[model samples]
Target: MSTATTQGGPELPQERRLVTEIPGPRSRELFARKQSAVPPGIGTTLPVFVTHAGGGVVVDADGNSLIDFGSGIAVTSVGNAAPRVVERVRRQVADFTHTCFMVTPYESYVAVCEKLNALTPGDHDKRTFLVNSGAEAVENAVKVARHATGRQAVVVFEHGYHGRTLLTMTLTAKNMPYKHGFGPFAPEVYRAPLAYPFRWPTGPDACAEEAAAQAIDMIDKQIGAENVAAVLIEPIAGEGGFVVPARGFLPRILEFCRANGIVFIADEVQTGFARTGDLFACEDEGIVPDIICTAKGIAGGLPLAGVTGRADLLDSVHVGGLGGTYGGNPLACEAALGVLETIEQDKLVERARHIGEIMLPRLEALKERYPIVGDVRGRGAMVAIELVKPGTTEPVPAGPIAARCHAEGLLVLTAGTYGNVLRFLPPLVMPDHLLEEGLSILERAISQG
Candidate 1:
């Protein structure tokens, strides 16, 4: 494996290579060490140990390079080790790492909040509170919603994924892995059906209307709008297979929330920061959520999540009630500033749309060729293909296909509660050729199946 920089000076190889089989020599040794050192509950998508990553490629310890389609589960939107992020983080670390935002506030933290307020979907006066992770952001959003409305109930969708915190786990619908074994979650969280057009018994437009009506009816009958604090949802369901709700669905829900005084929360942890071609996915439907939770890609692989929302709602919480030990570490805030700058200067939002333009046709062709490819959906760069058994709508778990693709040097992720969806979250800066090569590998894997 040769090391050479690209013409653009990004620290990445022009072409990918596989000098050894997956988990070869060095990776095997590292895996053995990891097995002994790391917790078993923390899962890995690929067995290979990542030595270096830049742009859309992850270099393994075994000297194999694979195109990353998962982007660290949608955390590295500006690409892993982007130059801007690296430089900013380095400077911030040298200055200071942490001072505890609660004790001594920093300019960078306030700057990040300013950027979030300016960029997040809403023209109203919005306040932002940075946190350590997506779950923390979700938990804080709940606290603010409850504090603002003096209500206890939070309404979330059936296939929605909030976080792993006790309160968020209760908000999440999945049981086996995320919520399993650690039962007895927090209370007063209600579940509603999302407008999943593929599975719902209606067309996209009608599915949106019906799902909204059903949810409103349920809220009135069961949870009562007055008792609910917020309605939380992912604009495009992330772990639930990139399920894009129909056009009118979010608008109708927003209308209901506004009329009833329930705070509308959009959990954009997976869809924010240009993953869905927009800075926030809610822009597509023209619905500005009252409270928007964001993380993942906000800080370019750093652990920084944010809760940006209506100023009044956020202000309702006591000043001391909304901070963490490392809520907005200096290093993370620097990274976030860099991330936002990168998105704008690099025009990654438009890049996401360009990726979709290239990927959609190829995915459509694959759908035509493979009987198992039941659906192709998602907006911008957050694309997914749902696999199902031929002649029937039964979900065909694509675990084996994903494994084979990983073995052949393509790192992909499976989503959906049934694990039947292959979701792609490639770096927005990925070169066209590399993106096409990854797609070719996907086609080969599916055709082989």
Candidate 2:
């Protein structure tokens, strides 16, 4: 990778420089090949193929640099090709690639589990196991919960996105792109209402109490609390939009879970590892869940997910039942350790909060200036704005606005069940000026839209 000087920093000169039109000739050719070779089911937000990425910029194959605000859907929190992650991964690659933890356990794997046990929320004696993706972590967490509690039902919230796997897709609420014709999904999964402040039938003030009461009442009456194995939720829902539940909702729901024997599982897949200004989003409310599923930001850009929770609950499962073929690959474990080191050394938690201080006010201003911006909400770097038509809450699709951003060399992502939420998860390492420029691009895009 090349390094250059910038006005603000002397490191990797991360800037938005458009050498050609957004999808210039090189990227268009690559995209054409991808369309022919890849399945139609797989979709891409930006057609530009990345050649090198670091800090806040993604350099496309055509030499155009786009300012990144999505952070690879929150995977590269420390930034792509982060120094620590790259060094560790390089060494691990030279030593060995995969031994499959199930066959031959390694020190790095144990170290990663140890870090997870100590880092995740809750001071209880915790145990951790690794997996390949967020969906696998959630599925395994559910498995352990069911085995420990001896229950068959799992409760999840509406507008919550777990993953794309069969069971996770069943747990997911959105129907179109995620679940359409994908079912019949796994059974015994029930959906509960989320305390979504903006869309709650009652106002934001009443959403917490009423939504929690209704959800608990539904579980009690419809699913039977005693029969429920787990209550899985995303502290701040990711793909469902960055919907931070009303203040008291999580605690209320957690109380109901404790009252029953159901395990409270926080799917921190998209909100963990300093993305939400805390090491984990659950810490914001001081809620310590029985099982916490984490992925995305765990290992920089490596494929690794972890399920960390109460030791007793995890130990309840049969010994051979929890092992996977490539669950804790050595390379990923090394990458995870490097990621942890980066989080600690770089003080990314504080950086995430600083990013929020920079972004939230700007987003709130957008809400004030644009009638199409219905609401702006989120914590730390994980922020979003829900789009709606003027004078009404009717959804205004986010696609046109996002397309405009892409054309202007800004990378952003859209979410929400109605496809109207523009979520921003900028890398914690992104410079302040780039953040401001990206937001300006977004403002212009919204105006044009």
Give lDDT tens digits, candidate 1, residues 29-103. Answer: 888898999999988788898877877788988779898899999999887777778889888888889889889
Q: Which portions of model 1 show Cα errors greater than 4 Å?
A: 1-10, 203-205
Per-residue CA lDDT of model 2 for 1-449, tens digit only, reads 33433222235666889999989999999999999999988999999999878889988889898999999999999988777887888889999999888887789999999999999988899999999999999999999999999999999999999998999999999999999988788999999999999998768999999999999999999999999999999999999989999999999999999989889999999999999999999999999999999999999888999999999999999879897888888999998999899899999999999999999999999999988999999999999999998877799999999999999999999999899999999999898889999999999999886
Off by over 4 Å in 2: 1-11
Evaluated at residue 135, the lDDT of candidate 1 is: 92
Model 2: how far residue 45 lies from native, Å: 0.4
What are the per-model C-alpha RMSD values against the true structure? 1.9, 2.4
TM-score of every model versus the real structure: 0.97, 0.97
Q: Alpha carbon lDDT of residue 353, candidate 2?
A: 100
Q: What are the lDDT figures for the candidates, one per model? A: 0.89, 0.92
> What residue pairs are clashing in model 1?
none
